[model samples]
Target: MSDASRHLDARSWKALRDKSPEEVADFSTHLSQPCEVCEAFLERSDEDDAFGVESLADEALGSMSTPREDAVGWARLRRRLWTPRRAWLAGAVAVAAAAVVAIAVLPPVASKEHEDRSWRLKGVAPMSLELSAVARLPDGTLHAVTEDDLLPPEAVVLVRYRASEVSDAMLVLESPEGPAQMLGGYTLEAGTHDLKEAGELAGVSLAGEHGPRVLVLAAWPRGPRSAAARDAALTQRLVPEEAAQARLRLRVEPGYVAP
Candidate 1:
């Protein structure tokens, strides 16, 4: 989870929502912790959180004596969240935008190796749908593991959603030569799916000469070849076979996938 999502819980959300967007920055610095409450808040049915966020935003907009846009990014966020066809506006937008608001005025931050691996902890994906790195253990069990997690030498890479609700999923693996289609015309119906098992494995191997690689997963109302997402970037114009696609990028470390 991002630093912002980890700390923001229901109480905090209400408190922050009551404040003007500009005041949100004051709450940002203290959001660093493993927060199950916030995770549950996000895990709730889509409509529940959406209504809460929108209601708060509506109230905020109503109370601001200042110009609406001048209230800060919240106003724009409110508009974006309510747009029809955006099913993911709840967890992704709320957590991400709130986090950014909290940290906007902060000083330059430093990076560390731990942060790279821990990105999966956010329990959220960056796209309208959800996508995360998955791997199989030596015992043949599957887990929603991230690149930061240790994988055995022979572990196979896979992808799955944050929840079963997000649908019409697709995947593409980027190579130095170009993009390789993994499972373009498919939708994930359940938990972890081995990339090799879900699609044709002919000549496909993340452990092959490519060394380590990047896995791109998309889940939207669209297919492998069409455009369904409002964000142009989410639309995979490159692949034009199935429906529209929105993507989240995940890295598989070279060493982890090495032979």
Candidate 2:
């Protein structure tokens, strides 16, 4: 064995290569890296190399009418050092060893695509939105709710939105008196904004007998609009058709529970 091989770290298998004569005896069980190990093993095997060389020399000699004149031993040394015999046997053994190691390390999670790339807590995969939005629970895990997804009475919801363009945005909620209640209004650009406390959304306490409600998010041009005009525009329902006519940008309606 070379001095570099014995003291190598097993943690880094890439550094391992087959260099020892004894390794060829048990090539199947060796811990050497697949690529370097097989190449090194075949290069060191004298019997296989000698047979290969003889076969190559025979083929060359048969093709030639006469041997080329060589005064020095340079051509002879070159022929001895370099020959193109395929070392498929060594490569096959190395691949088998690599497969065994991979199976041992990641056997349990290898078949599960989600488990392999997910966080410690189980994750929901529906957040692949173009305008990406999500709601987080109090425990910091993501909370995905439909009409079927229920939340606790005191569970603080975190509504997050990632804007894709520069525009003015507002998150509005339906007030108890039946007009549009603006929760937040800001000049937002292309970035993320996290709203942690979602009540009736107008700072109104939500412990009373209010049914399920939907929060509307509107994004428009960043020019001037009076409070009355903004209220007039927002007080009405922001359906898909109305938003399209106004040339409005993003209109996200993320609903929540106030029970």
Clashes of each: 12, 1
Q: What is model 2's C-alpha RMSD?
A: 29.6
- Checking candidate 2 for backbone clashes, the offending pairs are 18-37
lDDT of 2: 0.34
Q: Predicted candidate 1: what Cα RMSD to the true structure?
A: 25.3
Predicted structure with the largest lDDT when compared to the true one? 1
Model 1 residue 129 distance off true place after TM-score fit, in angstroms: 1.3
Which regions of candidate 2 fall more than 4 Å away from where they truly are? Answer: 1-142, 146-148, 175-178, 195-209, 224-259
RMSD of candidates 1 onward, in order: 25.3, 29.6
